[model samples]
Target: MSGPACVIRSDQAGICLFVRLTPKASRNAIGDVVANANGQMQLRVSVTAVPENGKANQVLIKLLAKAAKCPKSSVRIASGQTDRNKTLLIDGNPEELMAQISQLSGRTDT
Candidate 1:
């Protein structure tokens, strides 16, 4: 018997990021940076608004947009809308965007 099958594609445009969100904090700010066992950059953000009614999501989008220096409409929540870990679809070069994020977070991609 074969186990669950999966196919990995190489044409993917965006990178999937794992983020830890802290709602109801003082303001929207990026906190400690950690890397999972897989060496993925994990960031924590403290949002001022509660998680009710998609407020946290909006806050995250705004923060990311500001960080990316793009309009809010350009950054979109692709998945994990109801979960802390989210995947954002940014309409631009992933490599360049990742570089910008690395510069902002002071972390080098390894």
Candidate 2:
């Protein structure tokens, strides 16, 4: 599939990651960047943790931290906590984080 426009962006705080989280999946993984029905791009993430009592969300944070090579405390769910789609804020050097994200998603354009 063709890549979406952009799934990660830098702001005053740090890098903002758009994500579509799949809880209770067979395995935990970070998938490609995909566009939503409205054409907004988001990273695809799947975790085996069930979506209850913020369990899946916590797992998502840990997964992202490992993938991004950052501390788990640096990752936070900025929005969409109760939904499949979520916005994650990673605290660190935006450039470095963006580079890692691009490499992980296999998109050079971003």
Candidate 3:
């Protein structure tokens, strides 16, 4: 996958992403990486759905699957399903996918 927030790891299975989600935002979009109070970086993502009944999570998965150029089934909520901070498992080539996502995260400094 990647590291430092937008992505947590790049492994043979897939990429692991830590996302700080904002539900019911004005629109659905993926923003930049931001540090939490603990100084841990996370990707800032917003969705229009309320964070109930896993709707927001579903939306996030759909969005991410599209963004990562993978099937929706390939994106899974590895953890933090009921919380704003979520972990995602994205299936595919980690190196290639991370490169694409790095651009989406606006990770020029990296």
Candidate 4:
């Protein structure tokens, strides 16, 4: 009941983001929010790290930290560590971090 947002949410701690990660993609980037088959919208993120040995998750966290304008250590996989769909918690000013994550969801430069 704490995480799992369609895009991002402001919490007492910081911000929560729902992400759908794609490993070994053409490139690493943050994409817009897209709806899945179940009609749940998730932010799209891609990394080049192979999905073996939890490397992809680490890459994702770094990328997200950069995109969210937060320190790398501020990002953490709150849930779905082994799954493409994950919840990343960013530790920072909730308002500022949410703005950054919103820019991610509203991206049109893909």
Candidate 5:
């Protein structure tokens, strides 16, 4: 079954992303795409890079940007830079954005 589209919330600063990151995995892939009962898509990523020297964070930004179909410069790690869970700022429609992510994750859109 296809996952539901993501919902983007506007903030005083910008759009926020609730990202769940997995460090030191075999590879980076969007997995377990689920929208919370509240309608927020909780994204899980498996990354091979260890969380050190901002390597994983940088990788996460690039990968997430690609998935969101936005320029890398458009995707910014707003908070939790030093933590596994991060909040991202991406400027775009949540549904269209999630569709791109599903494509990148090899999931067929419904």
Candidate 6:
């Protein structure tokens, strides 16, 4: 499979965000935009929660929801539930969500 095509993208369902999660981090926060070996961009996310029983995933959703100014219910993992890399689907206006994420990540490619 290919690396993440984009860090964030507008989707019919809302917005799709590619992220690399750092569980058991010192703190819960969103970092800068970064590229992988395949030159795919993804947001950096870190959380103090452990990577077990979906704890880290839950924290990730909450962190992103707050960053995007959206409700936690509006955010869900579209893929990579059991991996450090994840694709999140935030339910909202695609343009608005993309803009928010772009601002958050300091990347306007979206």
Weakest ten-residue segment in model 2 by summed lDDT: 1-10
Q: Please, what is the whole-model Cα lDDT of each candidate in the order they appear?
A: 0.65, 0.90, 0.84, 0.81, 0.69, 0.89
Which of the predicted structures, 5 or 6, would earn the higher lDDT when compared with the native?
A: 6
Query: How accurate locally is residue 61 in candidate 3, as Cα lDDT from 0 to 100?
Result: 95
lDDT agreement of model 6 with the native: 0.89
Winner of 2 and 4 under TM-score: 2
TM-scores for every predicted model: 0.75, 0.93, 0.90, 0.87, 0.68, 0.92
Clashing pairs in model 2, backbone N/Cα/C closer than 3 A:
none
Clashes per prediction?
0, 0, 1, 0, 0, 0
Lowest lDDT sum, 10 consecutive residues, model 1, at 1-10
Which candidate leads in lDDT?
2
lDDT accuracy of residue 84 in candidate 5: 68
> 65-84 in candidate 1: lDDT tens per residue?
78867778877776778887
By TM-score, the candidates rank as: 2, 6, 3, 4, 1, 5
**Clashing residue pairs in candidate 1, if any?**
none
How many backbone clashes are present in model 2?
0
Candidate 6's C-alpha runs over 4 A off are 1-4
lDDT tens string, model 4, 26-76? 899988788777766689998999999999999998898887777899999
Angstrom error of the Cα, residue 101, model 4: value is: 1.0
List, residue by residue over 1-110, the lDDT tens digit for candidate 2. 22345798886667989999999999999999889998989899999999999999999999999999999999999999999999899999988888898888887875
- Deviation in angstroms for 4 in model 2? 9.8
* lDDT preference between candidates 2 and 4, better one: 2
State which candidate has the highest TM-score.
2
Candidate 5 regions off by >4 Å? 1-14, 34-41, 93-95, 98-110
Clashing pairs in 3: 1-10
Please write out the lDDT profile of model 3 over residues 15-99, one tens digit for every residue. Answer: 8888999999999999988988777778899999998999999999998889888999989999998998888888888777777
